[model samples]
Target chain A: MRHDVILRVIAKLLIPFILLFALYVQFHGDFGPGGGFQAGVILAAAVIFYGLIYGLADARKLVPEAVVESMMAIGVLIYGGVGVAGLLLGGNYLDYFVLDPNPVHGQHRGIFWVEVGVAVTVSGVMLKIFYMFADRGRVDE
Target chain B: MAVTVLVIARSRNLFGVIVLGGLYSFLMATVLVAMDAVDVAMTEASVGAGISTVLLLGALYLCKSEETRPVQAPWLPLVVSLAVGAVLAYGTLGLPEFSDPKAPIHTHVVPRYLTELKQEVDVPNVVTAVLASYRGYDTLGETTVVFTAGAGVIALLRRRRKDRKP
Candidate 1:
């Protein structure tokens, strides 16, 4: 495989900012037009762009398949865990207000955690799909 | 638009159809965005322009893409589709006008979403709040649907560990 110096530099430069922006969007969701879903997609798109310019193998090396799989599971677990937290706090499922003494702050905290779950799951799912499709040739072998 | 669709349908070359399909989807996405439905536009542009085009091309690799005349239209499919479309349009009549403040959708639940959304979910984008919290159950189901589709595709493509069955 031929290495494109420009693409490599671009990936190096953009990836950190992409990740930072994703976090910013995730956290600042309450104050802005961005949120978990958009952040997830943008984050995944950055990784996808890297995989496209580089190779899938390189992308996988950076983010291993096992890690991706575990993340997928962990995301769901986090989401479900929040509901359980609410239940334990004497509220119905996913009742964020009951999760803490201060209802407003509790809502904020719950949404933040939920957004994290969403970001992880979305990025994991998208990467999985990209890998499956790009790995089509290997499967045929 | 009709001309574009006809040309796409009539194209003999597979590549031409693929390009045309992308163009069609691009145009549709632009229209959606122009109409202020940015979310729908983003989805259409991504899935339709990006993924659908790739999937179609990939499928084309697995089969011949030469266009052949349809022998016959299934009368049942045609009737069912038209009937369903008519019913859907009829249902739309009762729906609130687009962006109308007085519409029930805009008046009640929608207003609450637009107004109290930030205070509750703390998200400025009410759509995201609605998708992730207000109606999160539905979003969870949607996420599961994506996961299910991925699993289904993986299962379909996976090979047995050993070739020998006996």
Candidate 2:
């Protein structure tokens, strides 16, 4: 379904702001209500909105299925790899204090990385699910 | 179905229903955050508002858009749902207040986490520390669930490409 020209333009204008807000939610997570997962979903929703108003083909052009699959794996790997890094340093799994001698910095770094991993996994999953249903719905139609 | 009930109760068209459902899920997520159950809220809001609704509308393509005139009244399901709702509400009445500083949840292993969490995990947000470190295995299982879901989606949406490769 092609959106009207005005609505499409409005969507285009709004997309960037939505994305910015998601990013803001992500970074401000420590003090605020949102964190990686919520931010990731909100980000994906903006992309999904783009997909909805424009054609799914255009959305796929921007975010391919293969990319989403890789992102899913990378997210887990990132999370686990951080833990493994701690293990290799003679600490137990996911013990990020050993990442650096300074505990505060270590916590900061670890949380950032973990949140990145979460964000990647979640956004990828959202897009992947969208493709699945949207594709199936198209075939059914 | 749930959508019909929502529409009937809320007085909205299908598009409005979808948007309202999203809003409702988000509000529920907010409640979860207020309870400091960030993980559950994240999953609920994402899966409920983001994916499930899309999937429902997609499935709707295979079926009727408008509700069919009921051949029989849905009194049984209605009663069952109401009973379940009442039971859930009643259950909540016995629970401790949200964010109660004096709640048993705050007095138990949580204090230990607040004290030694930095020494052990170096994460400021105690929730992440517990989720990823204190209970790392559970986080791994959760990740596995995501992987399994990805696999399920792949299997469900598989397409046969018949041009000689396999």
Candidate 3:
């Protein structure tokens, strides 16, 4: 792993752009061809790329296993919470029209938050799968 | 595409198979884009070419690179698959033509989405509007599935790690 100077350097340079692209896809889903699923995978790919070059242990240090586990639940909660918020706001379950003063803005706000939740959960799922598989032999008895 | 699948079928090396699978996924994504299913294409690209390839590579590390020969002949499974394919093909004969405006699928909800989507959601991408707002419940279900998969993986692997005695 240490001998591949080019791989490490190239990965370091590309990771930020990959992450930025993921964010762009997430926000631009309404107008373009991406959303939580694609953004989440891209985000996970960035982390996986980092792990491939710098080692999984370093990657885990940056996004701890426990934290990743928590994120899985947190994202789901965020998504469901929005629905619950809508319910509390006098709308039907998961309804976004009653979210704000204007139905249109509320729809936008609802979609944004829901996509954010999806991104978080998706990225968390991907990272969790990677961690489990990568750590299979390394996690010692 | 056919050539890649043939190569994948012939290859015994898991690594090569995974790489070819990623290539196949990339091709499928392109096909989806050509069909104007950009959102689905994006998902296929990310999930198929990106994460699954890496996951397969990770799994490959814990297993043998080359596949072992199977004891049974492939003829029976091949025949069964061909039979199923024939049945599916026959079934398709009763369905509507591709992009037919009169198709039941196009007639029901498609027209509504096409007509009122802009006025209702006002989003340019109707796919987003449908997934995030119009059919929000389905999206919620999908998010829950992803969350559940993550939780299941953690429970299976991380718990085993903790159980290992020092």
Best by TM-score: 3
Q: What is the DockQ ranking, best to worst?
A: 3, 2, 1
Q: Give fnat for candidate 2.
A: 0.33
Model 3 chain B scores worst on lDDT over the 10 consecutive residues at B157-166
- Spell out the clash pairs found in candidate 3: none
Give the Cα lDDT of each candidate.
0.72, 0.75, 0.88
lDDT of 2 by residue, A17-118 (tens): 989988986787755556667777888888888999898999999888899888888888888888898889878888777888886677666777777777
Model 2 alpha-carbon drift over 4 Å, by segment:
A1-3, B1-20, B26-47, B66-101, B113-136, B159-166
Worst 10 residues of 3 chain A by lDDT: A132-141
- Which residue pairs in model 1 clash with each other? A30-B122
Winner on TM-score between 1 and 3 is: 3
Worst 10 residues of 2 chain B by lDDT: B156-165
lDDT of 1 at B154: 59
Question: Candidate 3 lDDT, tens digit per residue, A2-108?
Answer: 45999888888899999999999999999988888789889988998888789888999989988888878888888999999999999999899899888988999
Native-to-model Cα distance after best TM-score fit, residue B133 in candidate 3, in Å: 0.5
Arranged by lDDT, best first:
3, 2, 1
Return the top candidate by lDDT. Answer: 3
